[model samples]
Target: MTIQQSYKITPIANLLGRSGSSHLLLGLLTVAPTGTLAISDLTGSIALDLQHAKPHVGKDAAWFCPGMIVLIDGVYEEDHNATTSGLGQTGGIGGTIGGKFIGFSIGGPPCERRNVTVGVSDGVKSENGDVTAGAGFGWVDFLGVGSERATGSKLRRTEQRLLGPDGAHTGTAKMVVCGEVNLDSPSTLEALHKMLRSYATDDADRMPMTVVLMGNFVTHAVMAGGNSGSGGSIEYKEYFNALASVLTEYPALLRRTTLVLVPGDKDPWASAFSAGASAVVPKKGVPDIFTSRVKRAFAEANREAGVKKSGVEGEAVFATNPARISLFGPAHEIVLFRDDISSRLRRTAIRFATLSHDLEQGEPVEADATMMSGGLGTDSSTRENTMDVDTPTPAPAAFPSAESADFETLMARKLVRTVLDQSHLSPFPLSTRPVHWDYASALQLYPLPTTLVLADAEAPAFAVTYEGCHVMNPGRLVREGRGNQIGWLEYDVVSKRGVVKEDML
Candidate 1:
């Protein structure tokens, strides 16, 4: 008759008591193919001794694959100050038996283990007992190093530094997560889970959090090394999937977490080749073993959460909330996404535009034209030939009959005298005095809607005849003149005539 045997599994708490005085043993009786042993505190600290414990079988005696004995210890305190020593006892085997023997040590005053041994036995008295010891201790420092007084003093100093005499608040927080996560190890996962839980509970109100994630996250498949070569690894999709699974499992802790990914120089894509030979590279076929994966993971998460993403070039800004959020790449370039301040700028621009438009539409304003006629006076023989025949005759000549013969003769003689007096001015016949006065009378002021006048003379000295108005010299002061200047004369607007003041003449 053939029969099948079954074995009973036991929790480590059932074998070990709550205090630090118990011997927890497994694989000593009714050995099976494989099994696990754990010891934990239900309320307080629990410790055990396993110096005399032995595996069920001898070296080279294999029922199937090898089996192992696991030990776990749990404690709680304000600070870590416990010691774990000689917890694991592997007998006469090199590799893992009953799967790998795992030791879980959690919580307490930070503990340190010493004089632990591990490896294979070679049938000598001392050497045979020297198989690899799989035992290690892990603990948390409940209360940190500094005293309460010291902490308060540091906090006060920091506040004083950040907020000066004006008492303005300015503070920033920076968080750094260095090193890699071992996804394959269950024990490592459990330890990480506990650490994250503690962090979430302790630091929840911290704002403007700056997180810098560094180092190689994904491990190479064949080489199993850090920052080695690229390629020959699972694609990023699979990697992201695994990461998503882990994150989803811990949603309560990571729901509002903001992560920034910075790629290391030794990342996989940064390398030229993987093996000693040249191989064609595959796209999306190998996982990115760098910080790019972290960014991609965040992007996917944001998308799944229905966050809006928008940007230009390779840079992007995400508005997961009303708060402004911007993400950049590669660390070499910095991109800033901010609110528009153009509304303030538009006011100034509008003022300038209005001035320009008014200037363009209005008629041109005229300036005073000061004529310095060099060829104004000469002898009649020299002057008549130079003067154009079509030019208007002088007013004195045209109204010669109005003056008596004696007066005309006297004026002609006086004009001849004035011509000879100012002869040194220019050789041109028109520059003569009598001829100059003739040309000056025929001059007409151009009509303009607006005109500006600036003059050093005291007053205008001539009469202006235009448009049926015989405008007489009004003897007005040029300094307070309202009308524009017509040549050397200051023309009055109301009087419509160029007048010379007594002082100027």
Candidate 2:
């Protein structure tokens, strides 16, 4: 969405809860094919209505903040660029069409009507900014040590607090977060084993609090076909058996160190896997290995090796793709998300070409791609898809300079800016992007965490603290089977201070 097309519509209230099995008069809000929104009451208290109203202020529809709470004058329409003159109505599902909604009105006070653009000085404020939430235990050093509190912050849904809890910091030792490791390969497994053993050989007291291993644990064949057949299950069993055997070998590490395994797009036993869709999953773990035959195999292997595995049960933890790790009662919170969001943002972003003349004379690059709004009959809502310019951006003619360097880096920073600015994990259209409707809150950056670790398969590992939230992408363990890059964050449990490092594996 562009700045010129930005409009304002205030919200009234949001849907509270579920509908009961009673004859309830519900207001149904449906998006039609003509890019329009329609609101119809099932009880017939009001006639079928339709209207052309957009609740989104900025050109981008995802610019909504959590505190922008207002129910629509009619019903809320979730769309890309859909619209209508009045409102279209749909039937009730199980005697309830629409349960509740947050109302909105464009015909409100003159002061209420405001246009907001990304990175603009003037904009709507999110009521739930990360202010008071910072007073918790670990929230002080959440942006590392000696960072000022964010004021007049653009992202309103962020946590609002400047001080830490009225207690001492209790930081964990250190955490090693490595990106996608395909345990399907013997060489990869051996490499992981060596890495774990090296930590043990280094120092006894220098133990890591946790080793977060993001997944793609199995081979491509297993991920695509699944572990159903005899051979497939055996492959899985053997892989896990090797993993269990490695754990028994490192008793000291297992006892003190927690192993957090987050599943990837192809990882098995995740809620997203069962859903058979690649929506962002909720916070959960792998299928219980204790109840499965793998548990028996682990025990048998341990018994044969003369290794007692008692505390190892609680050591291994399965986490969601986008998960959080809170330490010392929210004194320090760590958020980890394993996704290709960087690439998604890069491709979907408005592409631009730096003109040859501009580069030669040192002028700012400008975007020339024409922005499209709407076209059709009686304005009805249609799915708003991500717009991409078919005309590829022209290659720059000039060499590198300090000024050009900033422009070059903007491509990467743009991704982080878009995500944080929108207060959404993935701001793409719902039709193309999949998110658990019920678990949508999982993507919200409300009360932003102390640290955000975005593990991606892209190059050039980077880190930036946004709105007192440390955002870092550790890159990947294996990118296209090229090489490995792992990340380690040294966190002091007592001082509440930490340093991030990305190393090649």
Candidate 3:
């Protein structure tokens, strides 16, 4: 089949505008007979040349094919250096450049070598303009490139062997559900229950379910009067315990389920506080404790289901059958089974065959010495290829002082705050105002499958899957102004249902 296509190209002058036009260059070429394909920029700003070599003696020749290529070139000048008060103050610039060419190659098979070169020169600038010229050349052997693509040997040998034979239950299913619930409000819980019921009753074939909880689950409680110490209130403890009890009763409902939790800022423990120690403790530390306690409750439930130990140390746990369920927590901590569900289901079998036919008439099957010419002799060639193999590397140990690591810890905490703040600032209106959670607050349970839960009790239960892994903040309900008026509950289909392939982009 032959396919030819072309389109008008537009370059974006401004990065911030919606109408800014930018084009991505991508091409694919397969030539049966060795040939050359050249794409020269009609605008004279870029050029691409590709060629394939003829067969060498009795061996196959090298072929050139690129999956993608991108080139960009333009003149730019910063106006800030100018002394003029008009356009210079607004960061404007004026310049003219001669010719510039840039190119990149991607996804070429083995036995091929690819080169990318950029050239820039000849430029004129205004009085205050700053200019620079540059050129570069890069060559890459397609046989051993980077981590993204697998070589033929690795794919055929190692991967094939690892897959081995197919087993029963090879078919897989995935379901993602996300939604928001008000931790302080009982009615919100009712809404969550309704959502969960809908998912529970849905047909698995059409909408395989995996649950993801994003955003805030609880309002933090504000501390008042004497209850201001590191220790949380007995009421707070009872509240979470009760919530755990409720969740445990629905264990059967979650058979084969995966849960993910992302905490929000309204969660009381996201703030900063004094830990009786000489150092300052983060408010988030409290919610983390609560999350740990809640996880423990889940572990207890799992044990009831015959699991001897809880897989609380990582984002995934292995069942008696060795089935895995991965968990991803706040700050993007991902826990997953070694064998990914989708990959397992999509495995394909690959095999190669050699075709031979008897030569016409009395043609000899064996070659003689007389057939040799120019250092090239004809004889049946035997190709010896290695089969499947696996090389394992030792897992790295965790940092000894991660708990006290200043830069990474601070960056992580800041990132958490930024995400929550951005979510809160989203244009979507909240049904109720957010409430602050405090040490002794009681949080009502919203019955969504992956409802993000947070707590304010400073020393709430918490756990990190691994050293350097992000800590989890258990779900909690914040105490509003005494009367228990629940804060806002916003329902989002994206959050309620886990991220989908399309949603990822």
The whole-model lDDT of each prediction reads 0.25, 0.44, 0.26
Q: Per-residue alpha-carbon lDDT of model 3 for 280-324, expressed as tens digits?
A: 111222344455555665565566655434222212111110111
Candidate 2 lDDT trough over 10 residues, lowest sum: 108-117
The list of candidate 2 runs beyond 4 A from truth reads 1-172, 201-203, 219-223, 226-231, 269-277, 289-314, 350-412, 479-505
For 18-58, candidate 2 gives per-residue lDDT tens digits of 21211111233333344333333333212212122332221
Candidates sorted on lDDT, descending:
2, 3, 1
Give candidate 3 misplaced runs (Cα > 4 Å): 1-147, 150-172, 197-209, 220-239, 272-286, 308-505
Candidate 1 lDDT score at position 1: 4
Higher TM-score: candidate 2 or 3?
2
On TM-score, the stronger of 1 and 3 is 3
lDDT of 2 at 105: 24
Question: How displaced is residue 361 in candidate 2, in Å?
Answer: 5.3
- Candidate 3's error at 118, in angstroms? 21
TM-score of each: 0.22, 0.54, 0.30
